[model samples]
Target: MKSESLWFIFINASLINNFVLAYFLGICPFLGVSAKMETATKMGGAVTFVMLISSMCAYGIHALLVAVNAPFLQLISYIVVIASTVQLVEMFIKKISPTLFRALGIFLPLITTNCAILGLALFQTNKGYGFIESFVYALGAGAGFTLALVLIAGLREQLEFAEVPNTVKGTALTLLIAGILSLTFMGFSGLGS
Candidate 1:
């Protein structure tokens, strides 16, 4: 059971069920904050931190909900918890690591409304992932999200020097690139199946 759950979490989070592609949760940051590699890396770290903490909190709260048989409140409960946690994390980062915090500070509030973080919590509960499983799943999903954002940032940075067409300048080109990247991720679908 342990081994199976571990494998399931890793594969699901990493490839077969990417948070960005399969779930379309964090498209906001995936597009907005990915302009520069430096900012992208900071955003990724902040997100990963939030994800890991939220996964643990979500799993514990989910267990409580299961005990009470009040699964209907899962969504609200998860959001409340994640939002509060993100706020606390943001403050801590601002005080402790101002430089790092500034880099990610602007993006911190954004994650509060980021569907990806909430989706991760809800999905873990809905799927009945154990504690360890949830943690690993969150880690994998964070890694995948970071990978996608960084890759896009790198591409966009290079495109800065290139002669992009007028029609496909700002968002059109980025979305098109994202579509191509999504197609690239599709190639990994068969790995865990």
Candidate 2:
């Protein structure tokens, strides 16, 4: 809750306490959208955009709720913020690139429910981060989520033609790769300590 430098907050969110690989908060979209590089990257953008908006709005809503002695509305308020942000993203993508839009499918809309965004909101609120700090935290979290998706998508794409045994083909191989990637991210835990 104490003040931390912006870079430290960024590094901590993006690497040390990664919303995906580190905390495993957003596994659904992580696995579902990570199959293709295009969809994965787009999904990451969508998620990041949602996170940033939701975090900012959550910070404001929390302050309002506190001012009115209604902190109990925090959860529902945060959900509304995330849902609204996702809707805007959905409409934007639909008009901008239908191909990418189609590629993302259900997972695109599912950003509304992605726990990583919610977690980021809650974490920032609980930590009592100021507006700028919350913004930077959301940025780092988004970058981290994007990095993880791109890495997994690239690796999975490469593995497609690797000719492995049947037992290690689908989800099995993906999980194996995810485990390794998680460990790889663990290396950054000591980054700013």
Candidate 3:
């Protein structure tokens, strides 16, 4: 029973209720950083790392807040945890790959405010997921986010070679592709239902 629920949560988070395609969260990074496969992959990795860490921290903080009868602090606590985690990722990227870090630019720091991360924490808490469940949910969300970004990046890369019209060449084409992708993802909403 426990395993079944966990599996459902994972699948639901990663596919059915995908943060990008379904919820439309984190569109900033999705549109801005998905121009190239390499940058998209890095952004995905960073978000996954932050999501995992923030999920764990949110779980612990929620528990502590509950124990202390201060559940109202959940939002603030999650924000602090997410911000700190993003900072760590930013510093790590800066140290390891200055080039990638520069490419990421302001979008990297903007992860702190990414609705997907905040939504993940809030949703897990609302769903009353346990520690392991929360971790799996975070992982699923991260994977789903990465999958969406990579798919869009791949499409955009291919689009570079295709002859596009003057009006639909840039953002117009990107938006059209995003809409198509969202509809395609909606097809999976009924799985295991």
Candidate 4:
């Protein structure tokens, strides 16, 4: 990853190895907020913002920990930073768009617990990515997550009027859609290399 081109890094993260579809890191928001395209987009933006901030902070924090020879604290430190970043994003969204804030409900602050953010930090560090590489990776992961959410939302929206069977409705239908979407992403696996 240190020598990988920025384009490759972005494409790999956003599509080939997507945090949601490939790694299944952030299923909570992927399913919860994906009920509507509007909410899904907003959640995607919020998650992306958090990922960007956390990526930068993770880069700095990893360097600082290594410098101090306290690498054991890495996991706890990442959680703390992710929590704080989510708080900042939550407050900012509340101020700029109260409707969205309410619309997101529990899932808004749930970004802190969304494993995709933490996974982004950990994956970049493990891959030995530099600051720029980490940033692009985070951006790609966020983009991929948004893409998955939007796709599911759009499909779920369409399913509403398809007159589906009663037994196959709700979670069953959502999971069925998600499984197909995940397989669809698998077709892009070759592009990462």
Instruction: For model 3, state the Cα shift of residue 86 in Å.
Output: 0.6
Stretches of model 2 off by over 4 angstroms after superposition: none
* TM-score, model 4 to reference: 0.97
The local lDDT score (0 to 100) that residue 125 gets in candidate 2 is 89
TM-score of each: 0.92, 0.97, 0.95, 0.97
- Clashing pairs for model 3 are none
Q: For residues 121-159, what per-residue lDDT tens digits would candidate 4 score against the true structure? A: 999999989988999999999999999999999999998
Tell me the whole-model lDDT of each prediction, alpha carbons only: 0.86, 0.90, 0.93, 0.92
Off by over 4 Å in 4: none
Where is the poorest 10-residue window by lDDT in model 4? 1-10
lDDT by residue for model 1 (16-88), tens: 7788876788999988889999989878888889999999999998889889999899888999988998898
Query: Candidate 2's residue-wise lDDT over 1-193, tens digit each?
Result: 5669999999999999988998888988888888889878878888888888899899899889999999888999899888888999999999999988888898877888899999999999889899999999999999999999999999999998899998888888888999999999888977967
Q: RMSDs, each prediction?
A: 1.8, 1.0, 1.5, 0.9
Q: Which should have the higher lDDT, number 2 or number 3?
A: 3
